[model samples]
Target chain A: MVDAGVNMALFAVVAVGYLALTIALGIYGYRKTLRNEDFMVGGRKINPVILALSYGATFLSTAAIIGFGGVSGQLGMGTIWLVALNILVGLIIAFIVFGKRTRRIGKRLNALTFPDFLGRAFNSPFIQVFSAAIILMGMPIYSAAVLLGGVNFVVASLDIDRNVALFGLAIIVTLYVTYGGIIAVMYNDALQGGIMFLGMLILLAVTYIELGGVVEAHQALTNLSPQVPQPLSDAGMRGWTAFPAFGSPLWYTFVTTFLLGVGIGALAQPQLAVRYMTAESGRSLNRALMVGGIFILVVVGTAYTVGPLSNVYFFNTYGETSMQYVGQNADMIIPVFVNEIFGGSLFGELFIVLFLLTLLCAAMSTLSSLLHTMGASAGYDIWRHVRANRSGSHTAEEVLHGHDKDLVRSMRAARIGTMVMIVVTVIVTYYMPANIIARSTAVFMGLTAAALLPAYTHVLFAKEPDTRAAKWSIVAGTVTWLFWGLFIQANNANQIGLRDALFPAATWPGVPYSVIDPLVIGLPVSTVVLLAFFLYGRRKGGL
Target chain B: MLGIDDPWIWTGHLFAIGLTLFCLIYGWLKFNDDGEDDING
Candidate 1:
């Protein structure tokens, strides 16, 4: 229920204040954004702290906290391994191994976007356009889901009209993104990131305090293993406190789908990768690494830790698992816990509204960045390239240095592109079923990994990047993952329905290759193809 | 170790802390080093 403490007026004052601050920042970004470079790459000199926070905010959308947090609530704290991966791979390897090189080369190539980076690296227009096309095609489903996540939360918490929240949220975020571009996105993301960090830290402290300290709470949770649901136990989950049984079905899933899929897939994300370009130099990103890592840990680690422990709280209070209280909806676990944590008192009431702001920050931060990426894919990558090729304009220097008249046209096109993509995302949100988009994130991640990662990594590291091999490798990965997701990966195939539409006898995925993530397959397929070409090229002295 | 028995789960927790420190120290160490390149200016 909407808290009695949180009336419309209180929320109104808070929301208005928050929006005012956000718009003030946007205007600041607008004033600072003089050239196209400012709009696209925050003039390639954004503060390290802002860049790091922006990257974290963009990476961990509202769906991640609520969705994955709920999963940990249901499945257990085993998912916290993703936090390790987020730091080890997502931040450390990403910033040190990949971020520095991507920034250096991106500057050298005068690339403005992820697709542009890849394209200029290979000197392949097809690579740039096709990569952008993949983003445009794949990202909308995820963005729509983010929009839905925010809208649904607003409807439930504030008791506002869903349509109003959806449109209101979209229009506000889209305005800043279109006008100020990445400068605004990064600056606003820093504020959102701070809010998220504060929210998570509060929840963590309150949770531990309520549970009588960390060890006691965990012990309480560990003692409740006997309350495991029959279906989950039978499926190889031992308990909430322990790992799923070795080599069990649950083990396969936790390892393949969430662990490797999202853990590695994070490395290839276009929105996150673009942040590497906004920093001034390797040293700036090096500085960003510490802030980025801690931010990720505080937010993601708190969710995973508090999630499983919630079982103890609920069981102690109501003799029910976290699942039982939420009627088996994993997404509600975190929200319900938050509402129940600080219930009834005046301070609790105010904190409830503050937590709601965290949700708003999470949603808008992610959505704005997604909007920015989609816009760049459309305007700067696809449209600009096509137009420039035909009209013989946008020389790399012109676009990079940002002094030419044509650059203004290009920037205008990007603004138009941001508006168009935001509308597309909102339309998708309006039409697509929530259930479908909610489950589509992993599939979307796998798709990006499959189609882009191998080629992207090759261009970054390879001394003589073979454009033909890179092209074919991308095609091979895209085709392989598409075929897999449609006909092999159980969840996606079932959603797409083509596999069973034709065959009609394929059972749900389990115990075999169907259970493997598409990225696991797609990345290898692309890598092997590239490797073969690499060997052949070396033999022939062509690459 | 902290009331959870499974070494696996606790190891993940420890590793998360370890990696965060790794990033913090690395960044701190590298914050002042501009390296041999990007120095012509």
Candidate 2:
């Protein structure tokens, strides 16, 4: 896009202007962080729009646009099913059912972090510690996923070297998050979400118009079925506009891994759940719901739409489908499409920079939220309990029930925890395999869902909230997921290399077990364990 | 109907729009309800 001097200068001016605005917001968030409460959840008084925007922005990162969007280009419109579930489950059910209760119960418990919320609710510090450990370990994979999406876009569009772009992006996110925590994260997310929403809507309309119209665009992509690559066709890819044939490996991966894994797994995400606690009241969350819904639709819906349809543009232009054109890295497709269509044209350079800004903001929003959650879990849930209890003045249990505890050092500890996690995340990002964004996201989300969802739901609704049921269910879910992920499912087994080292091949020769997501097996097992234990608890009159 | 003939694909698109519209109406209807009331507790 910056091939000419005039365009390069305009790009620089736009980049600088965007950076100035971001820095200003960062400073405002820093000044606003006068207390630990403000640092964690914005004093529990964040407005509805900001809450909605923050939630939406954090939910749909560059991973969604750059990673999944590229997959849509490669795979087709079947990914739209994910958008449907994202709205119904991720947005609607989340706000109306989970959010209201989380806000009310969070306020009642005086919980500052998600693990703290669980720990206080279940009256088990062990639950807090274990869940915190889970977040600390699993979140880096997702963080690396987001980090790579942003870096890849930078590498593709700006022609920057991969390592420099990776660390540079990481550093900018770190500066804002470490200083101001969730306040900085949410405020920046609001602006970022707004810009992304606008950009995507325009991109969607233009992409369709560029291809001829909505119907024309769809027809064009549908007609590319003959060119659907050989292995993919063998794996049941019908076309860009159709779902994979039922019972095929691609279908299992599509339905189980992407659609169900990401869709349902969104509920128990600590970063997203923590956002509900930021709102002042259920009414604010209620008002924020539709805004979040639309933001998701326009942002994710557009990405999914534009991605697969990019094939039509490429086919018409380059005489190859997107997969054939981009080679093995589906990650490069969207950025390449953006550049080819937008770069080197009159006034296209400015739009190109804005698109880059949208992606950077997305990476920042999601990364900051992940870092903050990890940091809070480490500092407040794990370390504070250990460190603060050394004095023996008050237990974390007593502190949750309204006993006052000094928290000044806890703030410093959280920032330090954030820094440590950032280093780990940067290392993970440095070595992450290519085209891993979507799969890694599904892995992390599925892990959280399996580990926390059943227990979390039980605590939300049960008056007495049986601790034994929750505790064992958490363990059962986690073990099942890990065993399947590491030993059976090629999706993770291939990445983690446990199954490969142990066995000759990644998966069994017999069936589709390799592609079936761990969530399918883990969640049901977790739920059964929870129900069994809860029934026993009730029979024992523990309720 | 939108040129993509697959029932699953079109239905998925319609479902997404339908859910978002439902959320929009729900938000408007419940905008001024009790801010702190909770049935769960």
Candidate 3:
């Protein structure tokens, strides 16, 4: 075993260095920020390259590195297909199909944030406020999930208390985001992303070296057992070279959870959407695609591959289930494996530093973006109503001036709101439920896809969106997802009850042989509502 | 078990590591140019 004292010292130096870099970036970003637009959208002058890296960095996060990587370890190397989908659907399709139009419309509308963009596009303050509220409520869970990633690594490497780690992370993240805002976030994202790329490369190299070779690793893994688990024992469990058998649960989870959820959901992501408005023009947006694609392929692709292959290493060393080595909590697998690999070697201390840096950057970049989005959305969408209500008390010129001040105040509120969000996330991290990343991402994107995807798709491709239909579609999708997430799916199986329970099985009826995720039910319902509304509007000469 | 043996697989991994490092360096240069433009602009 490695000396705990050396590990602690290495972890502290890395943590302090990361904190100092973030604070310096934040101070710089704050000084450069001269207006609300500059703070919120990086003055809409962000070059394609930084925008691309920031987007990929935010998108990858701890969710991609630790959560998905852990899942890949158990699910086998077939998960690489999801990485391909992330590049294709998440990056390419998002940029080419959705990004160009989003930038054009956003520029035309002078939209500074995602909710602001939506509100202007739809010509509805209600949509803006509604979307902003959704972000404020939903973002904490996602933030907490990211916090868990860093906290887990800290506990594994330095043996620090999880609560202490959580508090330290929350404070550092809040300080940078609260001061520097989006520019600091993006600048730091590019640097952290570079480190992440290098860290994964080192991990892949060492794992391959220790395992002897690719062929030997495969033969050892395959010959060991076919009876270990439902998914891992299958022929597909070897490495990144093969796909799982058709119709298997592993395949479904890959497609639904990682591929479809993250892949398609990236287009509608409020944080990423705001990036389009940050760039100068369509060309900058296009310029970003190559750099973004390669970064995603390297950082995400490496993490996913290392995740499953770690299984082979752990199994060989411990002579027991890899699960026994890392426990049922999949997030711990990567940290545990890293510690084991570099335990007593000179490389051990370096690995510890790199691992903590990777997680801290992952947490900071994702949290800053989420907080900024929340602040901007709340200020423009939610607070606008309060300003409008008090308008009757003021004269015409006074009202106009009040509106300007309200915009400023809303920006201030966003900063405060981010701090509030960080505290809530830290508290929640103390009492987290199981499958933190998968469940949280599922709920978040499921809600987003259900509520926003239908309307967003219409805005992008539909010739004429029936406003009435769009509103109803969003409402139906949003309500349906919320109902299932809160009521139908019990916190535990023992908590299942009548209205929440689906007859003939635990899931809602008519979605037989399925758990009836809201995306399954709400997405279809939203599409039907939108089409019906469009048809009705045309019939009434409203289109 | 489908027993398979090949010495080249070890070499393949070494090749992959080399290729990964090469790509990293290439990407760093390309991204660095763009980043400089962003900072200047």
Candidate 4:
């Protein structure tokens, strides 16, 4: 496909340049960081462009590209609706409807982290610790999912050994994140976001050209409609271009898990929400809304669009669907497409370098944000809170600023917690099965929405969300998500071990299992609990 | 146009891209015109 010597030389040069720039940014951020505020939220002065880029880059990782992109390739064009919803709901609603008050109150409350903000907003340390606990428990699985995408690409496209690539990426990201904290993450994310944007645009152009143009490509896809496997066609797949029949499993999977779960679920993401606290004023958020929207449209839209279109290109070139070409594992579709699509072309070697670097940038940018959030939760939210309690500090403000020791000790603890979580994430990556990246990502996102969204929305928009309701909402969300995931979602139920021995409950018997995701069940149940508690609190004059 | 035959494909893609541009332009104009100095202060 390519000349090994020339390609490796170009790749080496590009990789070195990319690494040098990322590390240099880490050093730059480290120098600029001084106080706890600077380390956690960049002293609340990040410009709009950087904040928007960083947020988008973190939001759309290799999981969106390789995992969901692969899912789009497997499932068809229905996933594009997720892109529409991402911009409209994920960015527009997130930045405009939620961002203004979040920044305003976050600043007024001096909230440095998401957990800190939750604790301060409702005046409850339990909320802070509990939210941190959820992040610490759930985020590593999501991070591992992101790592699988990057490592899979490295192994498949770059011809690197899987173990070496996995550990190597983990080590590099850990160093920079531990050194520079959130500031370093944001700086590197902005650069990575740029690469991802250009890379996706070039890839999309090349894909359309390779397919002999869009009309012919789609026509060819229509021609290949009968080639859809019997089970898929039976399950309601009409073709690559058309949506599945209503009330089908494919429809449920696409609508419930991918669309609703990732789209609506994005609002409650801790890492994404923390971005609101990093800006100087509401103006930064206002400016970011547009920048972030476009970035999402490009990065996420390219991934989902290119994913299904890969089927057209693959069938044209190899007489097989992308899924058939890559065995049963959909994760290999995008990497295989990149490897084969550019083969023997004049610029094949150059696109390969850009594509590989772009995937690395996407994965690292996201991993850094997740790990930073986890570290903050563990060190500041849990450790500092417990220490402050033991030392006779009752309020969150006291714990946040009671003694000089708070800042110094918590910073050290944060770095240590990050290192530990890095090791955990790498180990988890080894055990995660193929084709699980997108599903695992959806699980985390759905859990966040179920557990945090109702309470979080209440805190930002109204004054009625108090300590009691907040606690009940978190419990309701987490419990329902876990219960539905274990007893209902087929994939998750199988993992809980000895369902016969544990609960003696059969897997939910229906299309798309009992429910598509926890968001549907957990969200409604949590909302009901939230309102009930809010009313009870009002009656008792607790609000 | 790339001659994409499906109206849905092009229409959806164009709508998404158009909405993104609208957001960027609107945000830029609002930021510059809204007395950002006062907001920051």
Candidate 5:
């Protein structure tokens, strides 16, 4: 086995190499980036393949590999459905269905951000400011989750202090993003996505080999199902291979929160949506579909599939399931598995460093994108619009077609906004509970879906999406979602006043209430509101 | 009730693959029609 000293030396070498390469790319992007538009949208000339991989990398992240992987270790094979959903809805529909329309509209409007697109498309500054506010406010929670996922792995692998690791990671990510903007973020994302793909493939192979093979490992897991902890069995978990019992709490949680929530929610993710605007044309977007789909499959598919299989390995070696073996917090299961499988030998130590690099790739790629989006939303969309509004003579059109000098100021503000987001994310990361990455990711995605999906869908596909309809839809989605999250989901139910005021004895009652997520409630409400408004507007005087 | 024999899962996989193939073919045809003139920029 490689000693600690030697392992540290190897780690330092790989870490420094990765840092140097990413920084060099960032500098290269900075040099090429000319206008504010170029920084925000890569001059609308990003290579489709690069865009595909970058989008996939940013979408999956450590949340999939570590957070959701750990969930699958406990929840079992059903999670593969999520992988299938990610590819189908997240990649295929996203690139093929949404990408083409978004590109045409965004390019025509010269819309620089997702909020900017919405604002311009609907002719509603409210949509712009509100959507940007949602991103700025809600995205920090997701960013915190991503930061926590990356830092937790670092802490577990290197035996480092968690706070120090979090701070250090924030600084590194902030510097790259603030300086290089979207151009640098996407460039680095392509590199990170490559590393993530290779790492997942290797980890998948190593996991299956360690547990014998697929059939053997699965059979072993099935045989051990009776040993499933009482809490899980009570919640209707039959085994990892089988789906949870219909209408059970676990079933509700899995299908509602993890599956439908994230699956449908992905369509409206601001960061991912912005990617659609980056591609040059519908052809570029279409060309990206296959690459993006496969990347999602390779990264997400392997992580989730291997997650359930880890149970077999842990049961044989540690005489417990992967979740139990990792202790109570299931989020650490993937990291712990990495340590145990690849910890002892010299080659194992090398693999550990590579795995760390993979985690960094996943974390940094997503972090940079989310931070960039957050920055642009806050600075470029919200702050600038407010300023322009306050300046009495400036109409929205005049603000939109501002003088060239204003572009430089806006870009500077975006950098400052990026820095601010980093600071907020670090603070939030410090307080986050373990294993919240997947839940947090789902929450953010669902929130985006609720808040923006209906209006966004109408704008893209509708001939003339009614502005009143779009506004109502956003309100309905956000309200219903917030209500459910604050008072219905068991996780957040206890923290809200409604729990104490109405259901002190029973929080989040009913099958739907306890397990059915905001997406189910919020999305339909938003859609109905949109339809009602559209019909009303059409009947009244045409949209 | 579908148990491990759930057909929907398989259906999902096939559908996703189909969608991907469709995109690839459509993109190839569309770009081919857009032609070699503006391919680089």
Candidate 6:
């Protein structure tokens, strides 16, 4: 129905311009870099405004935009509840509860990375090394998921070859991040966040106009019968005015997949944890909270709201269910909606450009942070021990100082690690058999919740968490998630089996249905382990 | 004119209202910082 040619040309020009701007920013950031601190933590002097925007940019990515939005389109407006949670749990509680303490402790210890902080906190090099290893192993899947989003959007919007789009996006992000490091990534994230905010507003306005008014839209939806689209009808696809039926499978997926996966998980993210360390003071972190919260509200709130409304448009025009149009890939729904809504208009072109910029910004910012953490963990934590042991130097000061290098090598190592991660991610993406965004995010966050949440919670609340207990708690949590994820969940016949039920629509025959997600199973296990370890340590005078 | 039967539009309004309310709550919490400054250091 829309003119595809005009849309393609518009999107192409915008994409090219965005790519040029990002490269320029990367080069500019590269020239300004001075030392290890600057390369890794931006010299711990990032302004509150930029820090706030960059945090928001990194937090809400293609995962929030396309993936969650697609789920929202199916789940109705209740998805907005998750958006509210993102601001409250992800942003507010994060800034007030965790950010204040993390910044103070990180500054006290002069720790520039997540692993560095943990290593210093417990005075154990092993914790740092293990934490880094976990991030290196788990984070690539998330990165791959983001990369897939970029490729999918570009291919869909511009009608380009998927392979070309994938390669082009990956190369652009890698080059900028490798060159500029965190500084480039942060500044670009601010710009990308601004674009995302504006683009979503325009898209929302246009969508409203297309649907006539709010009242008419609701009545139209309500009038439709469940038999019209049986899955949607059952999935709580009432007139968009009503919430989904209580405890519907769609409702469960909406809550677990979008809400809990992102909302509660944001608190445990290592990438965001490092941001708390970037600010000059707790006050700076406080200032960032407001800016960050508003940005997330606009960006994430709009995506989730607009995603479901798209179903209405799709169903009406094509006489097909929105899910049918979405096919197996839930990530494609938003792009399809964009093309449907603005395919030929100038707004459409701008939307595509901004959207691609959003993806690039999200990928680069998150990747750069993850790489910096990986490098710090590897260089300062693991490699330091290896080098010290080999040279027979066991002194604590020497062990710490041996790994300390000039900023250039550290930066280069981070970039190299990033490249390695990218290759692995690309391979995973190419061979990925399921919904990369939802599944990968769920896995990563669930792992974090299981492994780090208990320790993190104790660190925040308890005056003195027994060191023995803390160490064992981390081990217990990490292993529990890994056991459920790899052994129990992975090997289950229902999910990821020969026929391949990716999400396990039903519980495994023998496994308790309560053990649905690793987070559900692992959280309680980690808590019990931590408590048991703590009590035993107290009895033994080991606290 | 399309009658008041289109659910997506109403949902959009609901979203707008809900988000606005959320923003207000967030603003209040962020701005009204009670004097509980326990420095971890």
Highest TM-score scorer:
2
On residues A1-543, what C-alpha lDDT tens digit does candidate 6 reach at each position?
232323555656777887688777766655666444545455345665666676677777776787677766655566676767777777667877888787777777777677667777766666666777777777777777777776767767777777787778767666755665544655777777777777888888887778776555544554543523566665555544355555665555555545676667778888888877775556555656667667876787778767766766777888654556767466777877887787656766676667666766676676666656665655555666665677685654455433445334544555566666667777766766534576677777777777777777776576666656767877888887776665455322334354244444544433233224666677788889889987887777853
**DockQ of each model against the real complex?**
0.52, 0.76, 0.07, 0.33, 0.21, 0.18
Candidate 5 stretches greater than 4 Å from native: A1-6, A23-52, A180-188, A389-408, A495-508, B1-41
**lDDT over C-alpha atoms for residue A447 of model 2:** 91
lDDT of 3 by residue, A1-543 (tens): 222323666666777877788668766655666554545356356665666666566668887777777776666555565666676667666765677677777787778888777666677666776777777777777777888887877777776777787787777777767554444556777667767777777878888789887667666665555525645535234333344545554455455656566656666788888876665555555556657767777787787777767767877777654555676777777766777777777676776677677667777777777877776666556665656667655442232233566677777877776677777878877788545675576667667777888788777666665667778888888887677655544432223344444454544422222333556667788888888987888988953
All models: lDDT?
Answer: 0.78, 0.83, 0.66, 0.77, 0.77, 0.66
lDDT of 3 by residue, B1-41 (tens): 12233232233334344443443444455532322222210
Interface RMSD for each candidate model?
A: 3.3, 1.3, 8.7, 4.0, 5.7, 5.7
lDDT of 1 at A107: 78
For each predicted model, how many residue pairs clash, with residues at least 3 apart or on different chains?
0, 0, 1, 0, 0, 12
Give the Cα-based TM-score of candidate 1 against the true structure.
Answer: 0.88
Which one wins on DockQ? Answer: 2
User: How displaced is residue A482 in candidate 4, in Å?
Assistant: 0.6
Whole-model alpha-carbon lDDT for candidate 1: 0.78
Q: Chain A TM-scores, all candidates?
A: 0.88, 0.91, 0.86, 0.90, 0.91, 0.85
Best by lDDT: 2
User: What value does the lDDT take at residue A480 in candidate 1?
Assistant: 92
Alpha-carbon RMSD, each predicted model: 4.1, 3.5, 6.4, 4.0, 4.4, 5.1
As a whole number from 0 to 100, the lDDT of residue A13 in candidate 2 is 90
Better of 1 and 3 by DockQ: 1
Clashing pairs in 4: none
Query: What DockQ score does model 4 reach against the true complex?
Result: 0.33
Error of 6 at A372 (Å): 3.3
